[model samples]
Structure formats: C-alpha cells, structure tokens
Target: MNILITGASRGLGLALADESLKRGHSVIAAVRSPEHGGKLAELRERYGANVETAMFDVTDETAIARFAAGYAARGKRLEAIINNAAILTERGSSIEELDMTEVARTFDVNVLGPMRVVKHLLPLMDGTGGVIVNISSEAGSLHGAYGGDYAYGTSKTALNMFTEQLKHAVKPRGIAVYAVHPGWMKTDMGGSEAPGDPRTSASGILDLIERRTAPSRRFSFVDYSGSAMDI
Candidate 1:
C-alpha cells in the first residue's frame, strides 16, 4: 500500500511511517519542516526509494493544493492517508481562563487541517479504493466527557463529525473513513507520564487499515486496539 501521513516529523506520525516501511509499504512522509527532517530523513536513507518526504502545513490550503497537483502529475496513487497533524492547546485552563486565539488555532489544525487534506487528496485515491484515518481522541467523545481542555476536546469532536460526513460522501467510491483514538502515548503531545507507545499504536492502526475493519456501512469510531469507541 502507498500511504501518505501528515505530521510525520515526530511522535505517532513518525512511528507510523517507520512501521509502514517495516511492513514493506511505500510511505509519503509529510512534514511541516523539511529541514528538520530528523528521523524521517534517516528513514529515507535507510529505506531508499520506499520512503519519500512531502512538505506542507495542514493549515495552509494553497500548499496542500500545490502538493496534491504535483502528486497527481506524478501519477501516484495513495492507498491510505493518515491525517495525523494536530495541536493541543490550553490543556488545563478553565473556561474563563481559556484563550480564544489558541482555541481557534487548535480547531484549524485538528479539525480543518484533515478536512483540507482530504479535499485536495481525495482525487489521488479515486480508483485505488482506500482508507482515510483521522487521528481523533477519546476526549472528543460526548459519552466520555471531561472538564478543562475545551480547545483540544471540542476540535476532535468536530473532526469526528467531519469524518462521518465524509464517510457518507465517499462510500460510493469504495473509500472508508474513520476517526481513531490512538491512545495516550508517551509522545510530546501525550506527555511523559502517558503509558501507551506510539509504535504499538501505529502498528495496530495499520493492522486495522489492512483489514478494513468497520462496524458496518457507516462511519466507525475506534481505538487503536480495533475496539469500538462510543460516539
């Protein structure tokens, strides 16, 4: 499978790129900073042609469109797109203490970012029949509501809605869309005390993709372990 992953510079995105390469799948590692390639550059060096890097900021629609046009020109087909680029802001702030600017930024990257990617790149998957994985979180679930972190939580909630709507629109094209909670991983976003590993989460997510596991002919919300998550 040819997979395109946003935010591939670090954390779960990087882990997912690595795991996909290990599984012998081609990867387009999309990172905001091409100069700060870090481990992704290493992966390209080690895997040679199996891995490639794409530069784009998910918040920038023009950049996304440019990348998409170039990709189409190259005649490359993507089997999956992992919308993993996101941001977490004002994690512990109370409602009164929240910064609205930060909240808007959060929604831009976490919600609209994936929406933009899918809009521009859906053409690449036209005939390939693929999967779209929006990296959501349990915080998004109204069934498991919590206090504080309103920015991150609500952005994910909106993302889940987008995923569902996109699923319905694209099911006719043989494409499946899902919102996945990748678990609390020990990454820069998840922090040091978190117990889950990005590597494990990436592997399980890829497994779910390869299997095309869905609850029915609808949008499914699931955890990294392939278990259903309450909406």
Candidate 2:
C-alpha cells in the first residue's frame, strides 16, 4: 500500500512512517521542511525507494493542492492518508490566560490543515479503496474534557467533526475516514515524562488502520487499540 503521512519529521508521524516501512508499505513522508526532516531523511536513505519525502505544510492549501496535482500527474494513487500534523500551542493554559492568536494558529494547523489535505487528496486515492486517519486526542472528548489546553482540545474536537463529515461524504466512494487517538507518547510535544512510546503507539495505530471496516456508516472517535472514544 502507498501511504501519505504528514508531519513526518519527528514524533508520532516519524514513528508511523517507520512502522509502515517496516511492514513493506511505501511511504510518502510529508514534512514542512524537507531539509529539516531529521529522522525522515535517514529513513529515505535506509529504505531507498520505499520512502519518498515530499514538502507538505498542512496549513497551506496551495501547497497541498500542488502536491496532489504532482501525484496525480504521475498517476499515483494513495491507499491511506494519516493526517498527523498538529500543534498544541496552548498546553496547560487556562481560559483566562489563553492567547487567542496562538489558539487561532492551532486551529489552522490542527483542524483546517487536515480538512484541506483530505479535500485535495481524495481525488488521488486508489480506486480500490482508501483510509483517512485524523490523529485526535482524548483531551478533545467533551465527555472526558478536564480543562486546560483549550486551543489543542478545541482544535481536535473540530477535527473530529471534520472526520465525521468527511466519512459521510466519502463512504459511498469506498473511503473510510476516522479520528484516532494515538495516546500520550514521549515525544517533543508529548514531553519526556509521557509514558507511551511513539513506536508502540504507531504500531497500534497501524493495526487499527489495518483492521478498520466501518461498514455501518457510524463513525466514532477511537484509540490506537481500536477502542471507541468519546467525541
């Protein structure tokens, strides 16, 4: 399968790319800065033709459109798209102390970014079928929301809505869209104190992707382990 992963420069995105490659799947590692792709560059070198790096900033619609056009021009079709690019700019901030500007930026990346990618890339998906995974968080769950990190939580909640809407629109087209919570991994954003590892979370997410069969048209926000989550 040919997969496109955004924010593949580090953290869970990079881990997902690594796990996919290990499973013999081709990966289009989409990074905002190809030059600063860090581990992604190493994967390209090690995996050779199995890994391809593409410059993609989820927040930039023009760039996403251009990338989709390039892929289409080459007659490429994607089996899956993992919308893993996001920002937690308002971590630990109370509502009274939240920065509106940062909150807006977070939404631009965490919410609109995935929406743009899905809208543009749907045309390039393989005719056989495809899956769209929006990386969400438990913090976004209204049933589980415990305050703080307003921007990140709100953006993820909005993303969940987008995922549901996209699922409905694309179900007849043989495309399955889902919002997946990848768990709190020990990455730059997740912090060193976080208990989960990226590789484990990535592997579990890949398993969920592999086993997904959303036949009922009843989309739900789920965890990497395939357990349902509150939206």
Candidate 3:
C-alpha cells in the first residue's frame, strides 16, 4: 500500500513511516522542512525507493493543494493518509489565562489542517478505496476531560467532530475515517518521562488500520490497541 504520513520529521510520525517501510509498504513522508527532516532523511537513506519525502506545512492550504495536484499529476494514489501533524502550544494554561492567539494557531494546525488534507486529497483517492487516520488525543474527549491545555484539547475536540462527520460523508465511497489516540509516547510532545514508545504505539496503530474493515459508531474515538475510547 502507498501511505502518506504528515509530520514525518520526528516522533510518532517518523516512527509510523519507519514501521510502514519495514512492512514493505511505500511511504510518502510529508515534513514541514525537507532540508531539516532528520529522521525522515534517515528513512530515505535506509529504505531507498520505498520512502519518498514531500515538503509542505499541514496548515498551508495552498501547499497541501499543490501536493495533491502534484501527486495526481504523477498518477499516484495514496491508499492511506495519517494526519499526524499537530502542535501543543499553551500546554499548561487554564481557560482564563489561555492565549486566544495560540488557540487560533492550534486550531489552524490540528483542526483545519486535517480537513484541508482530506478535502484536497479525496479527489486523488477517487475510485480507489483508502483510510484516513486523524491523530487525535484522549484530552479531546468531553467525557474524559479533566485538565489544562485548553487550546490543545479544544482543537482536538474540533478534529474529532471533523473525523466523525467525515466518516459519515465518505463511507459510501469505501473510505474509512478514524480518529485515533496514539497513546502517551516518549516523544518531544509526550516528553521524556512518557512510558509508551513510539514504535510500539505506531505498530499497534498500523495493525488496527490494516485490520479495520468498516466504520461504526463504536469506533469514532479509539486507541492504538483497537479499544474504543470516550468521545
């Protein structure tokens, strides 16, 4: 399968790319900075033709449209897209102290970014069934909500709504959309103290993606382990 992973420069995104390549799947790793794509570069060197890099910021609509157009022009179809690009600014700020500017930026990336990618790339995926994975967080769950980082959590909530609506809209076309919580991995975002490893989390996520045959109300929000999560 041909898979595209955004934010493939590091952390879970990079790990997902590596895991996909290890499974002999072709990967189109999208990074904001191709020149500084550290682990992404290593994947290219290690996997050769199995790994390709595309430079584009997920928040940039024009860049995403251009990417979709270019891929279509090349007669390529992405079998899966993992919307893994996100920012965690204002991590500990309360609602009262939260910076609205940061909140807007967070929404732009975490919420609108995935929407843009799906909207533009859906054409390229036409006639070819595929999966769309929006990397969401447990923090987004209203039922489980219990903390700070107002902007991040709120953005993820919006993303969850997008995923839910998108699933219903695209199901007839054989496209399955899922909102996944990839666990608290030891990445830059999850911090060094995080117990989960990116490789393990990514591996489980890939397994779920490969085994998932249909969309149901039961799986609107789920973990990498295929367990249902609170939405």
Residue pairs of candidate 3 with colliding backbone atoms = none
Ranking by TM-score: 1, 3, 2
- Best by the TM-score measure: 1
Local distance difference test, each candidate: 0.91, 0.87, 0.87
The alpha-carbon deviation from the true structure for residue 158 of candidate 3, after best TM-score superposition, in angstroms, is 0.8
lDDT, candidate 2, 113-210, per-residue tens = 99899889988885847788999999889999876778998899898999888888887988877898889999999999999999998998787667
Find the 10 residues in a row with the least total lDDT in model 3: 211-220
**Candidates' TM-scores?**
0.97, 0.95, 0.95
Preferred candidate (TM-score higher): 1 or 3:
1
Candidate RMSDs in order: 1.2, 1.7, 1.5
- The candidate that wins on lDDT is 1
Give the true-structure RMSD of model 3: 1.5
For candidate 2, the per-residue lDDT at 1 reads 88
Summed over model 1, clashes come to 0
The residue-by-residue lDDT of candidate 3 on 1-231, one tens digit each, is: 889999988899999999999998999888887574877767788889998888889888899999889999998998889999999999888778988999999999999999988889888777777888999999899999977868899899999999989989988988888899999999999999999999998898788667643334555788887678887
Model 1 C-alpha lDDT per residue in residues 11-70, reported as the tens digit of each score: 999999999999999999988876756778789888999998888999999999999999
Model 1 clashing residue pairs (backbone):
none
Where does candidate 2 stray beyond 4 Å? 212-217
lDDT of 2 at 174: 84
What does the lDDT read for residue 8 in candidate 2? 89
